[model samples]
Target: MKVVKVNLAKNVAKVDIGGTQQWIRLDIVNEVPKIGDYVIVHAGFAIYRLDEKEAQETLSLFEEMLRHEAPLH
Candidate 1:
């Protein structure tokens, strides 16, 4: 799945995946994520949020696949 956008408010986040948006309630027991972040969404919930580097890498791979780029080591 691809994370199209992230909207964070207070402690919760609304992650938009593909063309669908899902509301993820953050646990008050943990830290809150910032806006424009990428999260690992499952079952209408965001389990974890990826860092900027990882998010960039993921999007890069998606773009590469769309362009049919060869895998690099």
Candidate 2:
């Protein structure tokens, strides 16, 4: 999930995975993500937050990888 909406008081965040909203816990995150942050959720928890440039680059790489896989498979 990239986009995030956090309710820090409740220690939960609704993240946008594709177009759907999924809730993830912030208990294990150490430093919680802000409203506009980009994060990676693992096991229903926010584990990593990526900066804007990193998020863009990682997404670009994923898109490139998808394009490569589609033709080969």
Top-TM-score candidate index: 2
Candidate 2 structure quality by residue, lDDT tens digits, 1-73: 6656778789899888568889898887746788877887789988888877877888889889888785544
Count backbone overlaps in model 2.
0
Model 1 vs. true fold: TM: 0.52
Q: Which tens-of-lDDT digit does each residue in 1-73 have in candidate 1?
A: 3344444544456666566776676663134556666776566566777877887788788888889876687
C-alpha RMSD by candidate, in order: 6.4, 2.2
Q: Which stretches of candidate 1 lie over 4 Å from their true place?
A: 1-11, 18-20, 28-31, 63-73
Cα deviation in Å at residue 53, candidate 2?
0.9
Q: What would the TM-scores of all predictions be?
A: 0.52, 0.80
The global C-alpha lDDT for each of the candidates, from Candidate 1 onward, is 0.63, 0.80
How close to the true structure is residue 45 of candidate 2, measured as C-alpha lDDT? Answer: 88
